[model samples]
Target: FQVKKKQFFRNFMTITLFGAVGTMMSFFTISLAAIAIFSRMNIGTLDVSDFLAIGAIFSATDSVCTLQVLNQDETPFLYSLVFGEGVVNDATSVVLFNALQNFDPNQIDAIVILKFLGNFCYLFVSSTFLGVFTGLLSAYVIKKLYIGRHSTDREVALVMLMAYLSYMLAELLDLSGILTVFFCGIVMSHYTWHNVTESSRVTTKHAFATLSFIAETFLFLYVGMDALDIEKWKFAS
Candidate 1:
């Protein structure tokens, strides 16, 4: 138990920290290119706010997608590690954006630095420790539950409720909702549940994941077309 807990923490930290650095690198390059090619101006004159919104929108790699792949029977540690880091970076980006909008950068000086560091320390420790303990408790109840395996469909409902509701509840408490969901996932994975009537859990995971990818693709395509048209008009004018 202790080993697993330690591994989980270590896994969370490495992926979250390194993943953020990598994301910034990609984002920085793309932002520069967008300014150079789109605006026909030097990067030095570009406003940071323009690119910042898009960065925030796509900043975090979707954890569901990564886990969707890793939950498979033959997934590797590298996959999990990358997925974990992506999740962490996404969280960091959102939190960072919130802070940016709420406070002034100039105010981030000495005393402010101490508060910032202290707040993060509190959030990380409290969220992780509490999230895991909550998950473990839920697992204990679920493992003992006999929810009438008579209907696999019903069992899947329970899984969805557990995942979604727990996440929402965690957020209302001002904790890391994603971490809570991930912890719940790990806990739920350890228990026995009715097989999904439509298909296996892996299949369900994949189906939803594929749907998300499709939606993201078409949505981005439409948005890109509109943006390009607007850009061309602006250039022509």
Candidate 2:
């Protein structure tokens, strides 16, 4: 959402190329390489779908740290390209992973491939629309209800809850909750941000930043702990 609209449009093609097409290429490349290596190594046989799923999982890239170091004002095009690519890459990977989950090697055919493509399109489009709708609804509620005029706390709370609502609704419908919440945030920043009180805007911004930092901290901490778990290693051995 912080991305300039004009800049985003200007670099849209590049972003899509690197994001969607590149991710798919990476997924297939990784899957094929893994399959070849495993075959030669005589490792236990694994299904093609399993290898593709793993590829999809690892293909999603995060550009948060890169973007943090980038000066958006000075390098708006570069920043937008990287940012947009990261977003699309993640969405494409998730859609690909979900689509591949139902794949069967024995059933592989032109029709099955077409069906997979159709399902991917359906999930991507539906999830995007759901996110946009939820964001618009939140904006409408904040604008028409005048909650911010009375209490900034209610305004802040409403925005946060609505964001959560979008995620929950997406998950409930078996859609991509991450994409839903992402678009929800974008919409909220675009529309709902203007509807809220000034204090609420500042408060909400800091609150979300703090929450993000805490979440990242815990995520890395847990990952490190899991990696260092001697008992788990012993059990596997």
Among the numbered candidates, top TM-score falls to 2
Q: Residues 24-59, candidate 2: write the lDDT tens digits.
A: 999988888988888898877788887888789989
Write model 1 residue lDDT over 1-237, tens digit each, in one string. 101333445566666657656666655566666656757654445455556545555566655544655643354455657666766676555544443343333455788757754665555566566556665655554446677244556555666666676677767877667666666666555443223333546554664567667986787789779778976888867
What would you estimate as the lDDT of candidate 2?
0.86
**TM-score for candidate 1, residues paired by index:** 0.58
> Clashing pairs in model 2?
none
Model 2, position 61: C-alpha lDDT score: 84
Residue 74 in candidate 2 has what lDDT? 96
Candidate 2 regions with alpha-carbon error over 4 angstroms: 1-6, 146-148
